[model samples]
Target: KEIVGVTRDITEQTKLQKALEEERDRALLYLQAAGVMLVALDQRGKITLINSKGCEMLGYSEEELIGQDWFNLCIPEEERDKVKMVFEKLMDGEELPYEYFENSILTKDGKRKIVAFHNVLLRNQEGTVTGVLSSGEDITERRTAEEALKRLNEELELRIAQRTEELEAFTYSVSHDLRAPLRAINGFAQALFEDCGEQLDEKGKGYLKRIQEGGTRMSQIIDALLNLSRISRGNLTLSEVNLAEIARSIMKEIMEQEPSRKVNFLCPPRLMAWADARLIQIALTNLLHNAWKFTSLKEEAVIEVGERKEGREKVFFVRDNGAGFDMRYVNKLFSPFQRLHKAVEFPGIGIGLATVQRIIAHHGGWIRAESTLNEGATFYFTLTKGG
Candidate 1:
């Protein structure tokens, strides 16, 4: 006993206690500097502790907020009663499953702010409810931005609808008012050819024929424009379409139109697409027909319809060994009434590719062409799924 009573140095124990207290102070300082607002309220709903962020959010100093009644001091007047009732329930130790809610708070400057809060019940080791610990975020800016975006989208849609209606009316006027005159010019030219062949020489007859052809070509352009407009205005009926079947059917009709041309057509057995059937038909018809027309000069021509992947996207292509174009002019390929080949060399008013572009755009897709002079051309397009 005498040996055990000898004096023992307690300096190490005091140093360890001091280190622990310093670590706890550092942790509290970090919490106070946290970006999120943090607060603790005693069972009576009086503020027990509030971090620096919490005080900044309410525009108050710690001295002013601590020991203050939370519901009465911080909560907006409109929400104070409801918050007090909920506070009472929490104090009564009601078993709540993780409370999270949004409310407006009145800052010390009398300005209001929307706060989204997540709350946890503080309990002692014996499971006795002691207070409430809450973390909050200021959501005023985010909510305002979301509301502004919603309004902007609605306004944009209304403007688009109005513009589309005006465009439709203008297209109708061009189709009706202009077509009747073209028909008359074509009719008169044809009548001249039929009734006055004996009175005119070869050059006059050729001129009349040119007039008739030009009028007919104009009419075809008008029809193509109408078709293009309709594709944009029509309501899309989206469904799974067998693209290969459509290609084969179009090939059959094209072959019948020019039986003497030696052209080979190949397509996959079951190429599929998600698109409006009618619109897709028009697009494919233009592409395939373009291939057929351009390949007319070649003694042996080949055309293929297939789909392949570019990166992660599925790109459908119409390929041909025909008279391709100079890549320099590719920029104008999809423009209405723009042609790379001479009208005499390729029989078209140049609306086909434009129509195809409109159809692809309506389906939220893109189209491109690759060609080399005298070698061949390939057209690639993408149609979005379920678009």
Candidate 2:
């Protein structure tokens, strides 16, 4: 009976041992499978345990890392003292300022990598602090990318500031230097026309008139250029703006200027958008004026200002029954000084659409035109919601 009892006891003991070994193996497997580096340090700052990821990151075998001084081996020479101090404080039962922190570690290849670590204190069953267990993620690549982006942003800001300064200088020259000569030319031509009218014949008077017209046209172009420059550089003040009201006001001004012309203008009762109010006013005015100008030759001129929903976006448009151009030239439509029609026919300096495009772009919006030659044209634009 005693021999049988001994054999049964041995068998049960063997089974219990096997079960403990299996549990340990499972725990080790989980640590090895962890994506981040898992490390455990003893009270003396020696590595007690390290996972496969920690071994791979340090370029060392588990055998080499185990029982090694963690701070002296893995930490960079410059940071070793600081890191060791923190470990000592933790061992002394001081709470760390942060449970999560970042530092640099030395690699086997003499390279340094940034690590973001989340650390916790390990304790014995007696409630005494034993060591620290840490899970660290190598953030070298991410930190490098973020630093590069910051540098690039700084460079871009510098370039923009320089460009703005240059633009201001150019604007000043145009406002003073160019306009001075232009005013002189127009003033002299007017004087010649008034004073020498009796001495001048029809042809001479016609020449003087043409000179005056040329000077006036130049002045208008200079003003347009200044406006374009101003639109390109400014802080945007976004607000809720009634686009329909602005369009109606612009049309009213156009009608008053040309009261003899009969035209049909249609605008919705209300069309609202979130954008820079002044900028939107400028854009709408240009679009409405273009519509009125293009449809002047038509006996039944029809111009409409309206809005519609395109998916989640609100699309506002100006439609006109006018002399539209070929679709092929649409690419050049928004370029400054690019005109599809002759100046005599269009009577514009061709900067209107370019200005409109800049204003739309500033609002984080886009504009497009659709047209069939002599049929009609519609200009559609969408503003970024909430500006």
Candidate 3:
């Protein structure tokens, strides 16, 4: 009977040992597969255990990380003394559940990474303080992105401030220096027309009229420049805008200005955008009016306003079979007072395109033109995708 009992006891002991070893292996696998880094340190700040993630974050091997001085190996030199003091406090019976803090860790490659640590005091079975257990999250990428965004915002603000000052100077020059001489010239020409009308010949009278007309055109140009400046400095009110509706409204105004012209304008039913309503209306008006003026000589003029998908963006374009300009002068198309057509061909102050460009740029969008002489011209643009 005693011999049989001894054999049975040995079999039971072997099964228990096997089960314990399997459970230990499962625990180690779970630690290795954990997302956040896991580390254990002895009371002397020496690393007792470090998982694979912890080793990877430190840029070291498991053999190199384990049993190394945790404070000296991982903590940056300037911060090591402060961290060591806190570690010592935790070992000396601190009752805190966890200490949450952010600090830089030195890597094996001599670079530093930011880590947010959740540290807890470890204890023995007898409830005596033994060491510390830490779970660290690598926040290097997040911190880098935040820093980049901060710098970008700062630079943008500085640029805005400088631009505001420059706009102020431009406004003063246009208002005072430009308008002052224009008023005097217009006054003198009118005085000649009234005071010396009988003595002046037909040609001399024509000169006076021309001088007055020139002054008026100059005033109009000045007003257009002021409008452009306003667009640059104004605050934006963003909302859902219907491009088709805006185009239709602009065409109506154009038809009213010249009731005899017959033009076919094509616009989709529900082309939409997210932008400032007033600014977008101004842009559409300028583009459509430009098409109407250029197509005056054409017996049958066609204008289309619509959107098409290009890559991940929706590009909106205005196409017209009008007096298309040369591609060589395309670079000058959006400059203020830079005219491609002679005054006899199409009368304009040349600020329309520059105004359109300013509005588009303010909306965080870009504009481009494609044209070949006498064929057609297309202006394509994209709105700011995200704010």
Reference-based lDDT, each prediction: 0.90, 0.90, 0.88
Off by over 4 Å in 1: 1-6, 34-50, 58-139, 201-203, 237-239, 259-264, 295-302, 308-315, 320-332, 361-387
The residue-by-residue lDDT of candidate 1 on 120-236, one tens digit each, is 889999998999988999999998899999999999989987997788668867986889899899888888888988899999988998898788878887887777777788778
Candidate 3 displacement at residue 184 in angstroms:
3.7
Q: What would the per-residue lDDT of candidate 3 be over residues 1-387, giving only the tens digit for each residue? A: 355443345887899999999999999999999999999999888999999999888889999988899888899999998788777877887636338867899989989999998888888899998888889999999999999999999999999879876975678576657887888888888887889988999998888888889899988988887788788677789988899998998898888988888788899988889999999999999999898988898888999999999897888999999999999999999998999989888999899999999999889999999998987799999888343
TM-score of each model, paired residue for residue = 0.69, 0.63, 0.63
| Candidate 2 lDDT trough over 10 residues, lowest sum | 1-10
lDDT of 2 at 114: 97
Name the lDDT value of residue 77 in candidate 1: 84
Cα-lDDT of candidate 1: 0.90
Candidate achieving the largest TM-score? 1
The residue pairs in collision within model 1 are none
